[model samples]
Target: MRIDKYLWCIRYYKTRSIATKACKEGKIRVNGDSVKPSRDVYPTDKITVRKNQVNYELIVLDTPKSRLGAKLVDIYRKDVTPQETLQKLDLLKYSKEYYRKRGMGRPTKKDRRDIDDWFDTPESPENKDDSEE
Candidate 1:
């Protein structure tokens, strides 16, 4: 099976096109070397997919004729991703959740209007003196 097709079959990517795109971008590696989307994938081939800031290591166990069910996915490939990498992914998720305060993200519509009103209004007494010079 083609590398892209294999990835899609295993549900690694939502679509074959996405897998193909990833391969073209050099995000898919076979046996440690980046492979093209058309690269042939056979049993025992080692695959490394870089996605969502993680490097997923998989060993091909068999090539399925078609896409496999979520429960059956393990029959086709074996995931050997490191424990540390998965732990880091968990840490990354937690860090992102608290990266910003609840109300400190992008300004809301009303906040934007308030900012525009502030800037569009006449200069304040403190600002007026600086412009005169």
Candidate 2:
């Protein structure tokens, strides 16, 4: 199976287009070397993917023609290392931080005022009087 197809079938990506995009962007590698979307993949081949802020490493155990159920997904691929899982957790932490800092709803008039106030803070060195010392 092609690497992109295999990745799609295994549910590594939401769609084949996404898998292909990742491959084209060099986010997908085989055996430590970047591979094209058309690259053929076989059982036991190692694949690495970087999506968003997290990385994933998976070993192909079987090539399925279609997406499998959650229980059967394990039959196709295995998580070879903990790096990606750790990175994903870290990414989630960062995402939460971002949402907390930026707020989640559509920007209201008050929100815009707050944002402008933050940017206009006189504490910024560029706006400070250096000669005051």
Candidate 3:
């Protein structure tokens, strides 16, 4: 199976197009080498997927006939991603909490405009040029 299709089948990506795009962008690698979208995949191949600041490592177990569900994904690939990497994702989540609370959704238009205005405003007296000596 193609690497992109395998990734999609194993549920590494939401869609085959996204998987193919990631391969085109060189975000997917096999056995320590970057692979193209059409690259062939086989059992026991070491696959690495870089997404959202994480490098996920997986070993191909078998090729699925089609996209698998979340529970059935383990039958196709064995995830070997380090525990530290997952901890980092947790830390990143905490860091982002300082900026926005949970369930807040995206910033509203007025809020974005206010933030832009705040940054665009003049610094202060030092930034002003009112010297009349």
Candidate 4:
């Protein structure tokens, strides 16, 4: 299967466009070198991806005939070395914690006040010299 298609089928990306973009940006590597979207992928290949802040590494076990659900994900690939997997998990955990602590809710009055305070603070002044002279 093509690298991009395999990635899409495995649910690494939400859409093929995103997968192609990742390939173009060198976010995907195969056999320790960056690859294009059209590159061929086969079982036992080592694929690495840098999505968000985490680095995920997987070894292809089998090519899925179709897109799979979460329950079927294990049949398609296997997690790589323990240390790398732990690092990836840590990064994901940190990202989730950061988002949760920041509160993914609509801005409250207090939140707006905090934003305004930062903008109005003298030490972190906004550039007010917009007038072209």
What TM-score would every model get versus the actual structure? 0.78, 0.68, 0.76, 0.66
TM-score for candidate 2: 0.68
Misplaced by over 4 Å in model 1 are 104-133
| lDDT per residue (tens digit) for residues 29-96 in model 1 | 99999999999999999999999899999999999999989999999999999999999899999888
Itemize residue pairs with steric clashes in candidate 2.
none
lDDT of 2 by residue, 22-133 (tens): 9999999999999999999988899998876667889989899787777889989998768658867887988877865656778878899998998885576754667566
Q: Single out the weakest 10-residue window by summed lDDT for candidate 3.
A: 124-133
Ranking of candidates on TM-score, top first: 1, 3, 2, 4
Q: For model 2, what is the alpha-carbon lDDT of residue 94?
A: 82
Note the Cα lDDT for every prediction shown.
Answer: 0.95, 0.86, 0.91, 0.86
Q: Is candidate 1 or candidate 4 better by TM-score?
A: 1
Candidate 1 TM-score, true structure as reference: 0.78
> What CA RMSD would candidate 1 show?
8.8
- Misplaced by over 4 Å in model 4 are 84-133
The lDDT, on a scale of 0 to 1, for candidate 2 is 0.86
Candidate achieving higher lDDT, 3 or 4: 3
